[model samples]
Every structure is written in C-alpha cells, then in structure tokens.
Target: MTTDAYDHAAVCELLGAWAVHALPPSEQHAIPRHLADCADCAAEAERLRETVRLLDGPDAPTAAAEPGTAARNEPNPMVMSEPTPATRNAALARILAVRPPAPRTAPHAEPYAAAVAALRALLAELDPQPDGGPDLAAWRTPVIHDWTVQDTVAHLIAADEHLAAHLGLPANHPQDPQGAAAPGDTDWRTAWDTRTHRVIAHERTRPPTATVATWRAQASALLACPAANDPELAARAATLVGVRLPVAEHFLIRAFETWIHADDIGRALGRPVPPPPAAHLWRLVRLAVRILGLALGPTAEPVALTVTDAARSTEWILGAEGEPVRAELVLDPVDFCLLMGGRLAPEAVPRAALGDEAAVRTVLGRAARLAWL
Candidate 1:
C-alpha cells in the first residue's frame, strides 16, 4: 500500500497483533515498513514481540511448588497459566530486561553522562530506519517553543557549545553567527535565547541531518572532556548561563536541558517520555532545589517540603530555618522536575499541601518560575 493510504495511527494500533503474527497478510506486510520509519511504534513492536517470546517459553511452572500442591488439578501455583497481577509484573520485568544498562560515570559527572545517554536513546528513536517508513525530513515538525525537532537539536548544539567552548573544545559549528552582544557583555539568559534563535536560523540553511550530526558531534566532544570524568578537573568554578557554578554542576545543567528538550520532542511525537532514572533524577531534583532556595532567599516563609520516588524520599526546609515551617508540601520527584522545567504549572502539578496554603503556594510558584530549562 502507498504510505499515505496507510493510516499511521491505525498501523500503530495493530502493533500487538502484528507482533504475534495475527494481522492479515496485507497488514503484516505494511506494518514492518511503517515500523521502519516510526521509532515510537518500532520500540513498542519490539516490546510486544519480547512479551510474546516470554509468554511462549516453557510451560513448566516458573518455580517449584511445595510437595503437596503438585497434583491438586487446580491451577498450578508455580506456573502462570493466565494473566494475574504477578504475571503482569513478570511480563513487564521481561520487557525491561531488553534495555541496556545506563552508562557508568564518575560520581560528580554521573548525572550528566546518564542524562546524555538517556537523551541519545530517545533521539535514536527519531533516526530514519534503513527499511524506510515516513520521510525523516518530517523531523522539521514543530516540537516546542517554535522550535522544530531539528531546531530543538540545533538549540542544544548552541547551548552545549557555551560549556564546550569554556573547556577549550573545538567548535562543531564554527560558522554559527554571533548574537547582538559580545559573549560576556550579555546576560546568559538573553545570550542564550539569542544564540538559540541565531543557531536555528543558521541551521535552517542546512539539511536537518547536518544539524543532527553537529549536535551529536558536539555532545560527544563535551562528554569526552577530562572535566566530565574528573571531579578535580571540574572543580574550577566558572560563570556560564548566568550562574557561577563548578564545571561539574554545569555538566549537570547540560543534562537537565538535554532531557527537558528530549521530553518536548517525545511529546510532539506522541511518545510518553519516562523521567530520568531515580539516582540521576534525585541529582537533578537536589540541584533544582538548591537553585530554587537561592531564588527564594532566606526571609520567605518556611515550608517543609518532601519529594519522593518509588525507592526513597528526601525532605528539605525551604525558607528560614529558624522559623517553624508555616506549611508542608509533598511532590513526586518527576513532578517537581516537570514543574521546575516549566512544563507543569505550580497549581496544576500533583502534590499535597497543608497548613498555610499561601506559603506552600509560594514555594510551588517560585519553583515553577525558576525556568532553568
């Protein structure tokens, strides 16, 4: 069938049946071609196929049962004969097993390295498949803040160049036009926005592939710098992006922005992006909390704040420590990150607040306004 004749969404909905070879012959033929160009659907198809493989494994019980239970003729307690809550969990575990482990990094740069790796994985989904489906040229689709997928990547290339330049790395796009003001003369925020606009304009003059190549090359160069792997090397403080922070924290900042934009692209493409893994997520949360604290200063009303994930919980007292907390707020770590990224509004983010609502609202409002992303 012609590409336009096949509904992309309808093909996507058939992924499960296609994985199990249950689709009609014509659909079976069309789906693989569709999967080739569609990263989101391709990934889902792989997952469904993996699930089928696991479900088709040996019919013997998953574990040995106690002696007396073996001959009961009842459903085998050790074998998953049908889907149950536990069987569903086992299926999910099998699906996750297919993913590669996160890359290793030094303690200080771990968050950046992991976040970079995570974003790369997401970007890979956008890669054009050898067998072909939709034209990869469609990457020009609008992503966020008036940036197309290619433009978003071009923005990151410009963004990371700041740190890469500070580290003395060779520029990936040396011809990129300068903003209105000389580098340091402009505040980082103004410089940042201007750089993004200039870079996007410059990149539009080239093929989207060239933009992706430049971004990937620059990111790889940044990660390869000695500072990324050595805490001592990263300890030298420098001011970039309007904040004075060590090179290590700057690396974390690079990670934070990369993941956020990746999320923007994921959303535009209809894929739900999972938050960063727990360890790296907490690093982002802690850093954002510190920055938020700095923005709030010491005199604001104190609010006892707690952020939690599936594995653990962290607590902090926002505002003056000497004063009793006037309110309490609790949030999921991912929700807090989204709030800090400005993707979630202060009032709309899922959270629990008590005591003085105004004080809690202040903390939430300040967090949402941080706009570091």
Candidate 2:
C-alpha cells in the first residue's frame, strides 16, 4: 500500500465503486496509479471487477454511453468496443490470476452466485485496520433491526443454515441447548429467531474477521454443492423459513435476502449498494410476485398487479381464479422488493392504484406480511 499522498484506507474503500465505474473523476484517477504499487489492492480490484463482469454476463454491452449523449448521434465514449473471444478469454485469465474460478451455476442458481459475488465486492471495500484487525468501525456500523454489520452477516449464516443443512452441510454453530427445531415444527419462527440471535451473540464474542470468514466459508460450500450447478437436483422441494419451496426458489430467496441486507449495510456505511444485475433483479421481482399471489390465496378479491422498471412492465393477476380483476396496482420493481423485504411500509411505498382501494390494500398488506427478513 504505497500510494504516498492518498489515504490508503479511503482508497481501498472506493475500490468497489471504481470497479463498477461509479466513482467521480478525482477518485477514479487515483485507483490505477495506486494499484500499480499496491499488490493487495490490485488483486482485490481485479476480483471486484471480475464479479461485475459475471453479473453483467459475457456478451452484455459495457456502460459506454455518456451521461448527456442520448441526444447525440456520435459514438459514445463511455461504451467500450465489444470484446472478442480472445479478449474475453484474456479477461477470464486475469480473474483466474487473482482468485479461484467462480462456481458454475445453472440458471436458477446463477442469481445466488452473482449475489454472493456482489456481497464479496462490498465486503472487500472494508480495508484492514493498522493493527491487522478487521475494520471495526465499518463492521460495527448499525444496519436494520439492531444488527451491526457483523451481526447481519451472522444472521445470514443462520438464515442459510436450514438450506445448507438440507443439502448436507454441517451446522455452522452449535445447536440450541433445548434442541434444534425442524422447519416443520409448530414454533418454527421462534426457532428461527432464536437461532439468529444465538449466532449473533456467539459471533459478537469473536473477531469480526472470524465472523466474516465463517459466513464466507458457509456461502462457498452452498455454491459448490451439486444442486447449485444442476437444475434437476434443485427441483427437489424442502421446507425452510416455514414455507415449502423447491431448492431453486430457495436459491432465489437466498439471493434476495443477501442483496437486501447488503443494501442495508451500504446505507449504514454511507456507501451505495448497486441493485443486482437487471436479469437477477427481475428474477427476484417475479419470485416476490408469485409468493404474494400465493399469500393472497384463491378466494380473495382479484387485483391486477404490475411491477415496472425503466425497461419494461410485468403484470400478474392475483386472487380469485375466475373473477374479473377488481383493482389495478402498480409499483416499481425495486420498491416492490423493499416492500416485501419489510424495509418499506405498505402505505408509504410509492404506487399507483385504481378501482377498489380495499382490494389493493389487501395485496400490499399481504406482501408486507410475507417478509421474514
């Protein structure tokens, strides 16, 4: 870490933004020069940049358009020329140089894999302290529900425990003294909450680095499992979080919560957490809608639900199977996720609605209740 004039800690914290081309000009100019002399930063930078590449997929166009160039006919300087196979391979080689190849995942698991990568990218921004401890200030920053950054990571460990155990991974923490309650048990939510608190309590007694390592090791094991790379294996259903869903849908659920909590941590640390890649975001959106429909059930009044982003709008009719749609409701996809994640109050979330107000309320309330995160 030999960038003489730049504060190394600040520089390291900005690496995630730099890799995503999100930094302002002054910050961007310092990174490359710093990376030339700093081996650790350089290696971490390559990993974060590679993570972004995977999220965007190999053939997706780079963000080359200039901020104000939408009105211009000239080629945008922001966009890079499309990569040839040779170039793509060279990039992959660079990724391999810095870390092991990312695990192969089928379409269903891809979002979860990319999400794990995204969280890694965010965590990489926390430069180590002078005494060789994890960055305690950043790790202690408060996130949602009285959780510090490290506690949130611990909670994720507990959240993923059921699925991991179902797939034959060993438990990451000791079982409750009374006994580990199955997901099918009558008091499952209590069991789940108790486990999360227990994990957080135990993790608080260890170094933050230890907590992070524990979380990462479990996440890696989950991704390396056969079901993560095979659709047929993920087709098998298991009950977790008090709901029975296929392993594939469970993977998406993992991706959803990971990104949401990452966003929570980012806000606490005063950094921005980019939403998942568009395709991944859509996967989460579709999943939330399906779950919402199920919660609404067959006999409730029908509402036409539309979720939108800049590129498109997707519509679904919720409630009674044969009834005419009694009301229409619209919400942005990100807002919908936040709503379902319990970060947004149903009444406070931005939306457009018409026809029966009560019907729309039922959908929004049910969606909010769906959140266990």
Candidate 3:
C-alpha cells in the first residue's frame, strides 16, 4: 500500500498482532505514524501492548535472537507452527480478560495511575466511527456541573495542576493566576473554583481535541514524576485541595476527580461507566470512608455501616461509639461513593437502613453533603 494513502482501518485491524510482534514486517511500517495521530488508536495500541507484555511474563526475552546466532539456529522440538484460528482466538480472549492493565506506579500512586488509564479507556470509547464523523460533536454535550465533556476534561487539567505544580512538573496548559496562589494566601476551594473557571474559559478558546490533548499530556507527566514511583518522595505532607496530607493521598485525589468526571461524561453520553476495578474501588472507598468518618465527627450518633462488594464486605462504625448503635446501613460500595460525591441524593440513593430514622437520615444527609466530587 502507498504510504500517502495508508489504510488506517486495515492498520487498526493488525494492532493486536503488531502488539505481540506477530505482524509481518511489510505490514507493520505504517502503525507508528497512525498511532501518533489517532488518540483512539493510540489508546487501543497501548492496551494491546500491555496485554502482550503480560502474556510474555516478566522474564521474557528483551530482544529477538540474531538470524545466524547459535541461539537462533538451535531450535528445539518444542518449536511449533502458527496457531490455529481457534487457538489464536482463545489467546486473544485471555488477553482481553485482563481488565484495567496495572498502572506503572509505586504502591501509593497505583490508584491514581489506574484511574487515569480507566478514564483514557472511557474517552477512547467516545469515537465509535473509524472515519471520524459527525458523532464527534457529542463530546460538546452538557455533562455535569454545567460542563460539557470537553469542559469536564478542562476542569481536570485545572484540578490536577495543583499537585503537578507542587511536584515541580511543567504545566501543560497555561497556568491560571489563581492556580499559582501561595499556600494559605487563598483557601483551596476558592482557588480551585477560580482556577477551574479560568481554565475552562481559556480552554474554550481552543478546540476540544486540543483541550483533551493538554489534559492527557498533563496526566502522563504526573504519572511520570519521580514521586509517583518513590514512596520516599511521595511521603512528604502538603496542603492540597484544603486537606493537609501526604503527596500520596493527593495522587488518590487526582484519581478520584478523574474517575468522577469520567463518570459525568459517561452519563451525559448515555453510557453507564462501571466503577474502577475492585482493588482500586476499595482503595477509593476506604479513603472516602475515612474522610466521611472525620466529617461525621465524635459528637454525632454512631451508626453501623457496611459497604459490600462481591468478594468482601467492610464495616465502619461511624460517629460516637459510646451509645448503642442508633442505626444500621448497608450500601453497595459504588452507591456509597455516588452518595458521597453528591451524584445521588440521600432520598434517591438505594440503601438498606434499620432502627432510628433520625440517625439514618443524619448519616445519609452528611454523606450527601460531603460533596468531594
């Protein structure tokens, strides 16, 4: 095929094989350029690459043997012909089954990295048409907080800037004046709201694709920071988003916001975004519960709350422990998160509650008011 008229569709179809180094050399030359220009294709390529890496296992060879080398000449009886179609299909199925590829992060930054990957995957789903047609306009439709999908991403760019700057990473987009306020000169909320507005306003002046590129680049930079891979660097405490906490938790905050906005975009597009993979969900849930418990305080009546998932259930004794439990609440972990994020109203959220009505109401109301999202 001529380079000038390369068939992107055909190249995309070969991505899986290319990812596994199974593509013939003649057919593989065009993929790099195509991937560089195409966001959807790039995301799919990365996922396929990750799947291939996992299949190869950690100790796999780094390079192919030279054609005339002893290693290449000494083929054992174990060598086999190309896989049959069914065998190939089964291998592909197994690779695809490994959901949410593990993020390249230190233990503490894992949640944030995974959340970023999840959001990238969701955004990749937005472009359903290979030719890139009118359906692209859907990205501009209103999502949450009066922000469109494009605006929501721009908000994340602004949201993540705080931690990025604190780590001394270069800003991907122009910095909002408010975003650079000295610590304690401005409260996080005021600074946050101001920066978001300014960032959105600035982003509106550009195309949505540009805004997304900026956001993606910034997130990539954050994940690449030394702090993301070093517990020692990330252990330092700092004030971000109104909470004085270790840099590690701030990374989680980034994960939390990215997942929340991705959900917002998913909802506006009429797609139900699944919660993060179980382990990441639990991390998020545990963090949110800790914050909620703090918000509930020692004086509030104690309630026995259980958040359940398919594999396990976690129990939290919320509020004062001196009195007999005034209420019992059971919630699916995702529902509890939605409730705390203010995405679900107290009256509307699904839950099982028994005992003192006032205690249940207080817990639910406080949960809704947490509004971290």
What are the root-mean-square deviations of the candidates from the true structure over C-alphas?
11.5, 11.2, 9.5
lDDT of each: 0.69, 0.76, 0.71
Ranking by lDDT: 2, 3, 1
- For 1-373, candidate 2 gives per-residue lDDT tens digits of 3346665554554564455543444445557767767787777876666565665576766545434446345433322234444443344323322332145568898787766765665675554334444577888898999999999999999988878878888888898864443666667788889999999999999987788789888988898899888889999998878778999999999999998998898778765666777788899999899888888899999999999988989999999988989999999999999999999999999999999999999999999998888
Question: Which ranges in model 1 have alpha carbons more than 4 Å from their true place?
Answer: 1-104, 129-134, 174-186
Q: Which residue segments of model 3 deviate by more than 4 Å?
A: 1-98, 127-136, 181-186
lDDT string, candidate 3, 37-74, tens digits: 77877777777655544555565434443334355543
Q: What is the C-alpha lDDT profile of model 1 across 1-373, one tens digit per residue? A: 4656656655543443344333344555666666767787777776665575466565623333333544555432222223333433344334323332233456777666655554554554454344543236558778877888888888888888888888888766544445332235446687777777888899989877678778867776777678877889899897787677888888888888888887888678664456666777888899889988888999999998899867889999999879988999999988998999999999899999889999998999998877855
Task: Give the total clashing residue pairs for model 1.
Answer: 0
Q: Tell me, by lDDT, which candidate is best.
A: 2
Q: Which residue pairs in candidate 1 have backbone atoms (N, alpha carbon, C) closer than 3 angstroms, thus clashing?
A: none
Candidate 3 has what TM-score? 0.73
Best TM-score goes to which candidate?
2
* Residue 269 C-alpha lDDT in model 1: 67
Clashes of each: 0, 2, 0
